[model samples]
Target: MPKLPAELRGRGGPDALMAAVGRFSDLMTPLLGLTARGRRPAGPVDRSLQVVVTSVRAEADGVVSVRLADLAGRPLPGWQPGCHLDVHLPSGRVRQYSLCGDPRDRTAYRIAVRLIEDGGGGSREVHALAEGRRLTVSPPRNAFPLAVTARHVFVAGGIGITPILPMVQAAARRGADWHLLYLGRTAAALPFLDELAPHGDRVTVRTDDLGGPPSAALLPDVTGATVHACGPAPLIGLVRDAVRGRALSFHSERFTPAPVVGGRPFEVRLARQNVTVHVPAGRTALDAIRDAVPDVAYSCRQGFCGTCRVRVLGGEPDHRDNALTDDERRSEMMICVSRATGLDLTLDL
Candidate 1:
């Protein structure tokens, strides 16, 4: 419940906070280091802390945002726009959510969860939590980060807007040129329309019930601009194809697993465990590895989280994960999605 050092709160500017956090990163991880693609390795050190749920309220249809605070009225660790927290649910299901509240407000952290009826039960458990509930959570870890640019363009689909909201506000606070193209199934399904309305023409809301779907028209000329998008896989795919030949740089985050097209059943040879696990063609390598090991660490099995990363002593990996860098992929592989290009893969375990 103790407050982070005054230097961490930026009362003395960011340098002090960065240095302090970096020095104590093992206790509470630092948030600055990111790949060129705005990604961080998944297995951040064990730094979970306890916090109380101060409030819980509905944001939109099937979406609820919760506010968390330290029990002793102290400032929490500083986090930027695209960072997410690992929420350890009472049922022992760990889920990740983006921080949507003001980055300047270190006193409390806010995040929104969209209930997925068919999900792995994480959202359902979060929705059922009451006020004053205590929860274990990791310090903020950012896989998607906003680039410092003169002009920024944001595109968010459905519940994916949770991370982009803070980025928009950060841009506005810094007087950077920014615009948004927010899409949803219906107006009622959008969470922050009322808040975004005040931004005027800077924000555009498109719903399937009214405007059909967002087209290239909603996107401005991305020439020399940095684009940030988060949403369903299909929307991100469309954006990728639409901007294929443009000079713009695009960054995106998706909650869904990457399509493992044409992946064949492969064998994972656990060198340390001395066992051979067959990863079925349709199933993920993580599933097969977990079946054999039963205790391997993994989170966000969608390939974004690097928790399942292991050294590939042999075999050519298909490498479907979005988290690893080209250099990192040479030696390590995220077992959650990446599969063997050849018949068998030998893992260091």
Candidate 2:
């Protein structure tokens, strides 16, 4: 992989943060000509790379901290905060994980994976992975990005903190005024608290009584800063409603899929394969595909992962994958949650 340019570093006594900003800004200079978020490359493009596990730290019952080093005797892509990597597991399952380390180094990348009891083995396999394990990963891809507003307010719930970790670190490095309200079931379940304690005056930890709901009082008065969040659906709903149209800004990332609105049954016709399957209400296209064709496979059943992507030949598809843009939505498809607007949908399958 090509190392990041050296000019990004500030001259003389300037800091790495400014250097990174300058480096990234130059990469995005082409984007400045446009106002809308274009689909074009924002910076030097990142690619999928393989990594070797150097260490693993089990945080709690299911949470595991991971450190990845490049296996090709080179550094991983230098990714901005909030960038994620696709991990190819030994079980032949691929999952996306957020990079939680500083982006300045072309060196190793770090991430924390939480094992989900109900999930399909990816997290459990990752947690059990020992040192020397080889993991194939995508170069950093950032679906969630920071804004240049005056300040920032960060909200993280449980394992959702993985993606937000670097953002907080970046905020501190920029001397940007920011605060983090970390809401989890307990401190034992949270990681990196020791490192975050110094941000004490700025960082707040919230734990609710089992079976009770968590309050968002820690989200202090906000007028200028942008609020960024990532967590479970319930926490997001609560925080989203609380900050509805308030002076506080809001943004979030979800590992879990968004709730899909139930609708009437629809017909899915595999265009090339000539297989027509009726996707009934309460059933997704993937489910229908699996029942009729078990050869097809996917990692995240949720819309969050793009492993189940297919081509949309005709009809409007309700795109639910985090992998696509509005333009891509009109073209390709995520068979996992997407449905057909027309009675007959044509999919590449």
Candidate 3:
């Protein structure tokens, strides 16, 4: 099968769409506006940092770690262990990747990319870049920060280790008791094993080939210990189930979008534009709205960033994002990852 054009890939972005329009002018003349909408040049940017790729090396099979530094070689913005960088691709696609390098290395930032053969083109574009390539990136923003605790239980599954690697180092630096449970399909496929090896018994690297899927038995006792997990949904779900009904706090970051419940198509009314668009079961409200008004604000369509937030005039919203507080959800919703709870929704737009 032919690969879909980058413009039509992922949740859709204005820049790539416009770039496509310029190339196939006659065929996509009607979609010229879509290109403008994807750019959203008038929209606000959360972070603006210019950096160049200093190095790119394979950490494991299909996993490449990239180091970015300022052109002037000055200190970039400071970031915590669990913070992530929003890389703006040359194709106008934006992706978020965790910073896995040493936090003390203020001169540059490091991130690892794992090629997802079936994913949107962002990872493939990043993996294709050679050294000396320049890109715009957002200063680090952390939704998953390491909390203060006497002990921490870090669970990382495959590429999810990107963020947890630093947390484990931070835990070690602070002399806090911490245990890392790393899981993968095989030992060679896991990145940063050499770096983690020095930790000795504190880190347990397991693979499906050796044992099996991470079971509740492998999970540590969470009593009085803060549990931080990042991985595929199943592993996070397993940890959540294991630590349920306990006083310990559980923090997790998911690479996938939230599952839609009651996936019936719904109608969305944009109050200011006086337009109503139908959001199909598998599509997001953001996509539907953008189809009508291309300039709608959004960043991190996964709902981590509140850029796409809008007032909910009427209708219950199926809140899927991890960013919003309980109070914020009462009136506002992130249109990117959220959807209408019923047959129709009225938005401030």
Candidate 4:
């Protein structure tokens, strides 16, 4: 029999150790062909739901909205405005897309994707998908939830409008005082304009071509409103700067990973592999660990997916992700965006 990692020998209590053992068994089943007594060897169980592409509509220059429905015409799982789904592509790539359609509609779920020519290939695959194509997707998860406020200020940039659109609709239905400032490079590149038409003057459209690049001064007065912004890092930074020392609450969601504000070089010890890797001050631990363990799972490198999570055997982690709860942080870390506080840290691997 093969030896187990030192941390899994007797530590982590019975439930934790058993969970780790089960994960190990799942990992090893493909390589070892192990099975339960008197049962045939089986592949990993896929708990994701099966959905078929119902429609594909071009919303803008480089953006397209894809509608997904259950295979048997049954109602899909309910979701909120800021929720997103983890879509598994045919090329084995997983990407998270915000739920953009009306939450009251249970017949199907809608997501929009923007083509990135130089990106990691997920968007291109989504664009290539045809109607009737089957897909496996995880249930909707919300890392960004709408706050219950009497007044709201929404700022959306380009494709970032996907999640905010539903929020705007919900706010209007509830008769809340809300406004949206939509920004993009060109009017032709902006999406879902017809949907926002009913709101009239409450929605303001700004294009770089018409009025130069955006600045913090263009934002409306967020005096007593809850401000929600989503966009590129620069736009989010502007929102943060505008809300600093203000009386209102500010929340933001980003398409890119948060930059390492105060990072330092550290050493990571992978106990199972008995290897040590150096993490540079400018690089993430995920990039370094992937050099040794190429099969490490990761998606949405933005630190919101929790797919790159690993068990921490030792050392204190400076958690930077928005996915994990306070309790989960005690024994787990998302290596994609998190780092160690001290000189060295250890992982179960």
In terms of lDDT, the poorest run of 10 residues in model 2 is 1-10
Model 3: lDDT equals 0.86
Tens-place lDDT digits, model 2, residues 1-349: 1244444445555466656776776677565553235456556554567789989987665688888999987966678877888788888778888888778867788889887877766888888899999878876777788765668888898888888888998889889989888888877888778778888789878776553457756576666668888989888887777777774467878877666676568898877668889988777888788767765657556665678888788888866566777877878888877887767688787
The best candidate by lDDT is 4
Which ranges in model 4 have alpha carbons more than 4 Å from their true place? Answer: 1-47, 245-247, 268-277, 288-295, 311-317, 322-332, 344-349
Q: Residue 302 CA error for candidate 1 (Å)? A: 3.8
Give each model's whole-structure lDDT.
0.85, 0.78, 0.86, 0.89
TM-score ranking of the models: 4, 2, 1, 3
Give me the runs in candidate 3 sitting further than 4 Å from their true place: 1-47, 262-264, 268-283, 286-301, 306-333, 341-349
Total backbone clashes of model 1? Answer: 0
Better of 2 and 3 by lDDT: 3
Put down candidate 1 lDDT per residue, 1-349, tens digits, no spaces.
2244455444653456556665665444335554434467567556677899999999899999899998777789999999999888887767788999998998899999889897667899889989999998889999999997998889999888999999998888899988888999998888977778878999988899998887877677777778898998889988777766673688999877766677799899999999999998888998888778876767688877677889999999999888999999999999988898889999998
Q: TM-scores of the models, in the given order?
A: 0.75, 0.76, 0.75, 0.78
Instruction: Report the backbone clash tally of model 4.
Output: 0
Overall local distance difference test of candidate 1? 0.85
lDDT of 4 by residue, 40-98 (tens): 56775555889999999999999999999999899999999899999998888788999
lDDT value, residue 343 of candidate 2: 78
Clashes of each: 0, 1, 2, 0
lDDT rank, highest first?
4, 3, 1, 2
The 10-residue segment with the lowest total lDDT in model 1: 1-10
